[model samples]
Target: MSTEVKLSQSTAIRLEQARTKGMSDADILKAIQANDVAAFDAVSEEDYRYDEFLSYAADHGENLEVAVQDGYRITFNTRGGLGIYLEKAFGVVAEKDFAVGEGIITGLKLKPEQAEVLAERLASNWVITESKDVPEGKVLTLKLRALV
Candidate 1:
């Protein structure tokens, strides 16, 4: 008897890349099981952006998850952080609370770049606002209203 397993697009691509680099199937399977594979090894640009979070997880040996509540609450594990250039740039604390308001200006406080990246990735209808008088000189707040 034989058993077959299906792999996600990203995983398949990674497996192929690893094979091309002379990694045996057994070695690849062991590495994957141990969570010790390099994220960007032999991956093309197209697959890399397919799901940015997967690359982050593979890189840090940690998982990143996001939760949305009522289309307003946007929270994610910032373990590996977002974006390739700014992994550890911001000092964000875990479980940070951001008030949910209906166009009343209340949400997560993030750097302008960080806010935009996260907002765009999470939803297309997020409203981002920047306030400079809030001690940080220039901070962008992320607010989600609806997914319409």
Candidate 2:
């Protein structure tokens, strides 16, 4: 089966930024077109484990999951880390008390640039306030609007 991932408009822009940062346009396009992880990693900065993290699998019987922390939406996968989420209350955030990964974070307002920076560091589909899914074999958790 093909394990390719399509790029969202934001992701495409992110790739474009990396390509313009000195990488070869041809190579960038190839990675985007094929959804190549290694290709993306080549252009990404060091310390970006999101690719591996994205493919990671949490130990069995774990609550590990990926979530948009404050957002009601969550997913169950094998990744481990923090995911950003939107709370019911506007501009409100809450850090969930997770077991494996760093907890969640809420009420922290970031500018577009800040979010972009975080996106690079996280290498996630989107910024997650805190997540441990995929790595933990569970769905995300955004129970409340208060810090864990």
Candidate 3:
């Protein structure tokens, strides 16, 4: 088998151990799948853009996803916790988040034009996540439920 698959298998085994240790179904899955939705702390925080995005959402708000950012709209479901993670590990797929910012502006009581401008700018920055200063050991983090 390929190295990637072998690594995945190893990770899955570790996750299974955790699952047997009385961890939540979600946490176990998050550890196993290691895919987009399962992008949690540690190694995941290192590479995944969505990992950083999810962390940002906790401080700013909840419900982070793909497509929309800054103020939430249509986006991916990277925030679904362990359910998404488990499905991915088993090779099962899930629906992505899809709520356009159509009425979000009015919903948030901001002017539509103003919201549009903000969205445009935020989307621009999303491509280039402003890196944070990482310490020696801690590094940056993903703020996954498993960690907290």
User: Candidate 3: deviation at residue 31, Å?
Assistant: 12
lDDT of 3: 0.29
Best by TM-score: 1
Better of 2 and 3 by TM-score: 2
Each candidate structure's TM-score, on Cα atoms with residue i matched to residue i, is 0.28, 0.25, 0.18
Clashes of 3: 4
Q: In candidate 1, what are the lDDT values of residues 1-148, reduced to their tens digit?
A: 0222222223333333444546555655454455554533543345343244355445643322211111122233221222221222233432352443343234345656655444434323344554443554344454444522
User: Which 10-residue span in candidate 2 carries the lowest summed lDDT?
Assistant: 62-71
What does each candidate score in C-alpha RMSD?
Answer: 14.4, 13.7, 18.7
In candidate 3, the residue pairs with backbone N, CA or C atoms under 3 Å apart (3 or more residues apart, or in different chains) clash, namely 26-82, 66-75, 66-76, 74-99
Error of 2 at 40 (Å): 1.5
| C-alpha lDDT of all candidate models, in order | 0.38, 0.34, 0.29
- TM-score result, candidate 3: 0.18
Write the candidate numbers in order of decreasing lDDT. Answer: 1, 2, 3
Best lDDT among the predictions, by candidate number:
1
